[model samples]
Target: MGRKWHGQFEGEVVTDHAEYPLRGRLPGCRIKHRMKRNWLKMYDKAGWILRVETVINDPEEFRVRRRVRRRGRRRTEWVPLRKSVAYLFRYRDVSLQSNAQYLNALAQVEDPTAGLRGLDTITTRKRSTKALNPVARPDCQLFTALMSGEYAVHGFANRDLRSKLAATVVRLNDDPRRQSAQVSRLLHRLHVYGLVAKIPRSRRWRVTAFGQRIMSTSVKLRQWQFPANWPSCMTPSKLVRKNRRPNEGRSYAPFSGGPSTSPLRLVTPAIACATNSKLL
Candidate 1:
């Protein structure tokens, strides 16, 4: 008989070659072979090997897909649940806060009076609204110019203030022309507020002490509230005097023409008469 492989066998020991064939291995060998064959068939049918390979190649892709599926399921499950209009308005308040921060920064550098201008842009019907009443245009612009000390008198005459404010509005919304109108209105309002004083003879303006105080307070408040990560754009004031003369240039010139001697010593009348007769 051939040597049998060493392993535990269940049930009766066989002695007859005709019943068990000692040299032909075990009877249940076929069963074990069938089990392995069935396992491989199931594995092939499931394509588990390919699935594992795809997962290994790009794990994040699968994770993203899974997240999307989860979100989709949650959306379907929770969309029916609704919130109050007041809650929605809260978001609007947050948006307004962000806008306020931007406007405040612009006021420090561009124009504090821009708020008045923004208010003027809204329709008259909307004038009573909280957002519309926050600030005036001229005030914002004047404050910005004062803080930055960058205002040009020429700009006021040419309506460049409106242009600058229009550009700012364009960054936030469409229809810049409408924004310009609003800026003009705001400037007019500033005249009402007495924060901005317009020179009648020329298209120029100067900020009042009250306006300066307001701007200072606004800047301090904004700095405390927003705490921007960027550095401030403010510059120190410089003392400038045009056509300044140096000490040496200011010194008086010495008395012109050489020193004088006392009336050319005598020979006075006599010398004068003799010289005159000789010439004749």
Candidate 2:
């Protein structure tokens, strides 16, 4: 629920994976969104009660504006969610409102894309539309560049990505304005695809949770099994041992279950038969 917020968010509030440990990793909300010090935490109690609580570690986070005198000049000052019995009602109201918003948004979600179906939108190319096609050599390069580890923190700006994108897709015009414009278009496409989102009140973008997963997988697809590098392919388990240019034609053989009740099975033996020889 906390992850639904379009602001600076990190981990999912309602994930089985625990980012924050409280007496070991518990399956519940332990997100530290609003601020590092102040956050809203909700978890199950006794496997029944839904304990939703907000903690304002730093009172200054919730500011109260007031006029204060400073050197005979009246200047406005701010004061700061939960830490006093006197304002318990205020805290409860705020917490309940946030809970309502989270639940409301979650309720309205109709058939959210939680499957791999969305991958088609990124890798499929249509000449008539300006959609991204990561399957292409150039587009795949551009797609991987956006997932650079450095930009994970504080997001990235046009200047930060422009040079990277230009380096990969050198076909783009040499003009800086053109490069910047191209990068802008790429970012727009990423935003449209939900792979990235613009930081509020800033000209920067951060990869969302979904973006991290989908982009990483998409990038790996560029190197998926093709020319004898199947070990590191996306489906690593599907190994191939076929007779190729150098290997003898007898690549696989059926194991004989002579006199035994065990069922015979076909297996690829490491040792290949010599040319023009037949196994007995």
The whole-model lDDT of each prediction reads 0.38, 0.63
User: Over the stretch 1-280, how does candidate 2's per-residue lDDT look in tens digits?
Assistant: 2223456656344323233334664444333334455566556543455655566555544534557788999998744533677666655556666677755755788764654567776555545446766557776686687789899898899998876766675366678898788788878877777789999999999988878877777677766643336445544222333325444333334355454555544333334444214542
Q: For this target, which candidate reaches the highest lDDT against the unseen true structure? A: 2
Candidate with top TM-score is 2
Candidate 1 at 95: error in angstroms? Answer: 60
lDDT of 1 by residue, 4-84 (tens): 334653423322111222255332211111111111111111222211000011111111111123644732221211234
Clashing pairs in 2: 62-80, 63-79, 64-79
Q: Give the worst 10-residue stretch by lDDT in candidate 1.
A: 50-59
User: When superposed on Cα atoms, how far off is each prediction in RMSD?
Assistant: 36.8, 18.2
User: What are the runs in model 1 whose C-alpha is more than 4 Å off?
Assistant: 1-146, 152-158, 167-180, 225-280
Candidate 2, which segments miss by more than 4 Å at Cα? 1-114, 123-129, 224-280
Return the lDDT, model 2, position 207: 89
Q: What is the lDDT of residue 238 in candidate 2?
A: 26
